[model samples]
Target: MNKKVILSTVLFLSACGGSDSGDGISLNKVKSNDKAKCSNSRLDSCYYDINQLALNIMFRKNDTGVLNVTASVSGPKQDIYFTGSDVLEIHADGEVFLPTNNGADSLRYENIPDNAQIYEFFWYRNSQLVEYNSIDGITEPSVILSTSQHDGSNTITTDWLNNPDYTYQIHTPSLWCTNLNYESEMFSPSTGILDNQRPPYQATLQALYGKNIESLKVNYRSCDISVTLIAKNNQVNYRNKQKRLFIHHDNFSEHPLTLFESN
Candidate 1:
């Protein structure tokens, strides 16, 4: 198998809810139902039923005259989660724009007209948007929603060992094996395989408390791999930190191993 494909598969399996077993719910359908409920209501409701499944929903009125709506479902080994805080402004003509804060440094806008309001949303493994409804009038969210397969178990085991202050673990896998060729060069590269350059090491990161992982980069040199994780708090200040680990292998070894943060 190709190295990138292999790494992608390995990371996909290691993260939660990649199993073939029938234990997860279809979050796309759930989001569709949730959006339908939002449109059907004069005011937002907390919970809604979709295909006989109950989902927790929330909405906030932002400063932009748009309603920020979020919907999520929680359970053990199985959960349906969806979130989009972009402004849902009802224009004087009743149109909407799901204006997204592009990056911490930039902003992008998606206009949602009134004709097409129904949307099907989905968030699959690696925070990838697997599927969604491209309705004529509904603008999609800027940030991708988090989703998991639900197996009827509502209990979720979170990582509280590293930081007890938070109850969940952020799932960010370092992509050193895929991106950096420490064995080939002593200097760190700036790009990755997906960027049309020598693959830079990469990692998938998950944030806690509904936080989105942002601004990630890797530093490599002299058989050393360093991962930097950053997240925005309260839509303003940034929480930044770095994870440093050493990579070494014997000349005869077939697979290289990395040791960092006790992992």
Candidate 2:
């Protein structure tokens, strides 16, 4: 299966999901950092603020969880995401972890630490080296995830303890044909016949079928893990979230708890 189908994306341009109700969460103001250095903005040593930084951890059904953290900086390619070798440091309980960075825009940390209740996503940004952060924790569904596919549709069942108090978000891919709807419409007969050249009915049907033509013969291609997040409401007021992390919860983890099989 192609691993790139359902790439996880969170917020950046603004806030969403809900307001910052501290509840069990905590946050720090984007404050001054003594280590910040920006003698000049045009130099490689200067660090710029990122569009977003996200840390996502998914607790699996039968094994350890997966961690994925990314920091996105919007600017010319000459500028780097971070100023130093240290990509990100996560503080959980009394221990600190530096997620592995293979020189990509994101970091990968495997197997969330046991006994971890609170997490501080820590990363660097700006010429002043102002610290960016968010306080988020892993929320396991009350009941494990189970999915069944029938007739190209998906049915997901989960127990969220008190289902009324929480909601679930399913991140999955649909038939690729659905995504190419606009392109398929271009081939429709109504699009108008060319100069002295009318489109044939069989040819038009073939063009409209496109990718699904293969699915008709070989079924469908398997997709990425269909991840789910279970969340509840909180009344506490935490520091307003920053570009550091934008998702109430990310779409997936490195591990698969549930999937949408090919039809």
Top-TM-score structure, candidate number: 2
- Candidate 2, TM-score vs. the true structure? 0.42
The lDDT leader among the candidates is 2
Full-model lDDT for every candidate? 0.24, 0.34
Model 1, position 41, has a per-residue lDDT of 30
Runs with alpha carbons beyond 4 Å of true place in candidate 2:
1-46, 49-64, 67-80, 83-87, 124-129, 132-136, 141-162, 170-173, 176-240, 243-248, 251-263
TM-score of each: 0.17, 0.42
Q: What would the C-alpha RMSD of candidate 1 be, to one decimal place?
A: 23.5
- The list of candidate 1 runs beyond 4 A from truth reads 1-95, 98-226, 235-263
TM-score quality measure for candidate 1:
0.17
Model 1 C-alpha lDDT per residue in residues 1-263, reported as the tens digit of each score: 10111112212122343322121322222222234223433122212232223333232323243534434333221432323211112121233333243111122334322233332222231232222212112221122121222112212221111222212112222233222443433333333322111112223222211211121124333122332211111211111111111111101101122321111
